[model samples]
Target: MPDDTVCDMWEVQRGFDELGRPLRDITFCVVDLETTGASVKAGDRITEIGAVKVRGGEVLAEFQTFVDPGTPVPPEITALTGITDRLLYGAPRIESALPTFLEFAHGTVLVAHNAPFDTGFLKHACADAGWAWPKFEVVDTAVLARRVLSRDEAPNCRLGTLARLFQTETTPNHRALEDARATVEVLHGLFSRIGGLGVQTLEELQAYSAKVTDAQRRKRGLADRLPDKPGVYLFRDDRDRVLYVGMSRNLRRRVRTYFTSSEKRSKMGQMVNLAHHVQGIECATDTEAAIRELRLIAEHAPRFNRRSRRQRRLHYVVLTQEPWPRLSIVRRLPRGEPGIGPFGRKELALAALEAIQETFPVRTCTDRFGRVPTRSRCLAADLGTCLAPCEGSVTPETYAALIRRVSEAMTVGAVDVVDALSRRMTIESDLERFEVAATHRDRLSAFSTAAMRSSRLTSIRTCPELIAARRCDDGRWQVHVIRYGRLAAAGVIPVDASAPAYVEALRALAESTDERDERTTVEESETLLRWLESPGVRLVDVVGAWACPVIVDPGGPLVELAG
Candidate 1:
């Protein structure tokens, strides 16, 4: 739990998350390099380095140096840069010059026109000198010009072209210092254009030069009020409808990305266009933020969110309560009934049901049976897949025993079903029926997944209430109160707070629950279980038994079910 490991499970937008700092507060090291050749891999090396550090349109410092390449300068390179072997007679080598440049630009954002060429050469120099390259935030002026200036404003992003367009006092002449000076002017000119589009921070400036649509960029003000903390955010339309919901460790940084090119999803772009405002809900911990996100998404069923919206479609495989028990696929399982799932897909539940039926001599037909059973039998009986209970071939007592086995396979353990399917797969494979073996493998996978999920969910659902705490990266304890697998309350224990008193207060503030049916969704229970079982988590207190049955394997050994 490193301090920087915030929201490890969530996907974060790539780039700097420093959106709070204004562009005027950022010191930029505008750098340019003259190289011996185009490709660094072709034994080319830096001939000269020129950089000007500026902040708020004020020049702070300038760095210029010539590096000896340890070889004769190419004739064409001399023609382009006007530097030759004679001019480099007393220059410092890269090993000496690289450290000085690095020290000069150590804490500033690196800016360059055609950044990759300049930064790539610097990185190569750092590597050759056995120095770890510092991770500097980079802004490319050429890239920004392409994003901000149209062809009518600037014919090309080349240094000479942009210099002429901006009427820069210093013009680029293929020399490092002069080109870098010219780029400073071009950079300022481009920043002014983006400033009108609401790009005010270094992070926003970098994102504005990306593939973000102009329409999306214009809505940057929507993220202005968000706090830089762990929380959930909601995007709302003009009619106050929630278009999307999400959570992040840094709310401001994450929400800001929605209007940037980093959010590449086309549906998100449409959602952003429709969005008129964004709302933030600050939380005490990342876990709390995640749970809040799930609850919000479930509550609103936001159009742009793809998950947790179709809980109604979740299916389960249950043993039907009837005169003659049979495995059935169901949308909802009765309370106190032994069932296998809350499978997200009906096809998956069906596959688990098929696997159970294949393993046991249970009735697959959907018809209800009475004491005086019908004489007619389904095709399964003819195919010898069923015991033909309708024909009175198997006694009621015997059928009940088989039903118990099926229930056990679904509820207590699935080793029997796994063993049966595995044996069949072996026989099918031995007979060279690879495709048939593959089908058996798939069914086994479905059954095992359902059984594992059911076991995990049942363990948490049966518990009355549990309080768990884990030490955070900052040495504070994150405490959560869970009631019947639902997150009831979450709070943090300060470094100086009393642990028992803090937890007791948190528990008192938790949501109260009655002894009713499991109220938490399967997804929420699974999420809580994962957090509870994660490393370094300690169970502070438990009101009831909170443990899952060991999953047994077919090879005569028991194994703990992985979270």
Candidate 2:
């Protein structure tokens, strides 16, 4: 059994799996409001409330009322809405009418021609009346009309225009109940058009009506058959070339967003336009899904994906192997060599190298020296920046000592180096050399970040095999088999099965991994390390040693600098 704390963490839901209720089964409350003014913040109040609830094209109920605004209705409002102050003399005030309308619209999808206008006023009324507003899924028929109908089909998205387009029995006459009735007809007409594009669920309808392009809206059919499961998805062009790759806990919902206004990336819109099909590969665990995404992105080199494609170009700061060793940046780390990084950018690697040089007396010159010392010194040596090892002033043994210190600082905890740099920073501050102090602070930060990242990657990569399990929201256990920081296999333990036996069987069938194969990238290892440290993850088994070095103080200057 896991600890009480671990069991308590499992109560937090991971994600939703079920796709929303179907449109035919959902009840829609089409609502409209006549206001004293357009702006809710400028003391506008609802003068009339009207709504019609329908399910499967059948009217279930109707709610209509006139509210007393306590302020005189303007002549313009009377001319527009035909609502007079005398007619509202004996009507209920908004404080009394709001709760009654809310009760009628509760547990139904809220629909209106221009939803923001009506919904905004109602929200303000709820706030003013000291009543908590309910969370209702709002759908705007006007927005949906713009997405479904072109200018040739409908000149405008107004209630009267749509009522004429749909040829509804009730024409909008600026009256709340009549307009709400017309909007109900418009909503059904829009649904009929969207149904041809494979939108049968309320979630799909809401996404289809969002501010997406016509090209993207037409691509909604691509995500119709995707499963609601944890997996990787690929967007393929007409020629079957992958355009983009991604992963999510709910593949269908995540892929559907690519065609919705929620995806604001301009490049994604272009990709969706070019995509001819979408494919989903379901996985048993989210960890497996993440690793598969990284592998697929690396293998496919999809044009739209920006990360993990150039893993070969990652730079590392290494201490060269020579009689007079020096710090150098390389794309590939030599085997059996101690290094400090797998930085994504050369600039970051250079910064980490600079930080190491600033603290230790490591030589900065890029020269190949032999056992016989060359009697030559560079400008860095002349300025006392280097120990002048090439000039034969410093013996080979003394230089070796400096190399050991630098290597220890890179691999082990850099406690002494951090303390030395902190003291130097204080002295520079005392002398009022703020620019120099700032430079030192930045170098220290870069070094600390690189060291911490390398430690995390190394800890995961050095382990031969590791098994872990996390209980899902549905009471099933998601088991993962990881070898050398790569997902070897994955499975799920049923609620009635023993988790330990299931994990053991998975480990027996896991892929054989070679720790020295160089197939595991630094990003993949870091991804595994993060999963291993996340809440609710229980270690089931381990083969080799796994631990990270605690190098920096959590509340030290590094934290302050990061802030």
Put down candidate 1 lDDT per residue, 1-563, tens digits, no spaces.
33234323122223213435799999999999998999999999999999999999999999999999998999999998899999999999999999999999989999999999999999999998788999999999999899888899888889999999989999899988889999999999988887876678877787778887778768888887888888899999999999999998878778888988878888998899999999999998888888888888889999999985677798999888888888888888765688988888988888888888889888877777786678777788888889888878788899888888887777776767877888999999999999999988888888888888788887787789998877766556788999888899998775555666877899999998743645667777778888998998877788987885567666643323532
Error of 1 at 75 (Å): 12
TM-score of 1: 0.77
Please list the residue runs of candidate 2 whose C-alpha ends up more than 4 Å from where it truly belongs after superposition.
Answer: 1-16, 19-29, 35-46, 52-63, 68-85, 92-109, 116-137, 145-174, 178-203, 211-214, 308-313, 382-384, 496-498, 554-563
Clashing pairs in 1: none
The digit string of per-residue lDDT tens for model 2 on 59-84 reads 99999999999999999999998899
| Superposition error at 414 for model 1 (Å) | 2.1
Quick one: how many clashes does candidate 1 have? 0
Full-model lDDT for every candidate: 0.84, 0.82
Worst 10-residue stretch by lDDT in candidate 1?
Answer: 7-16
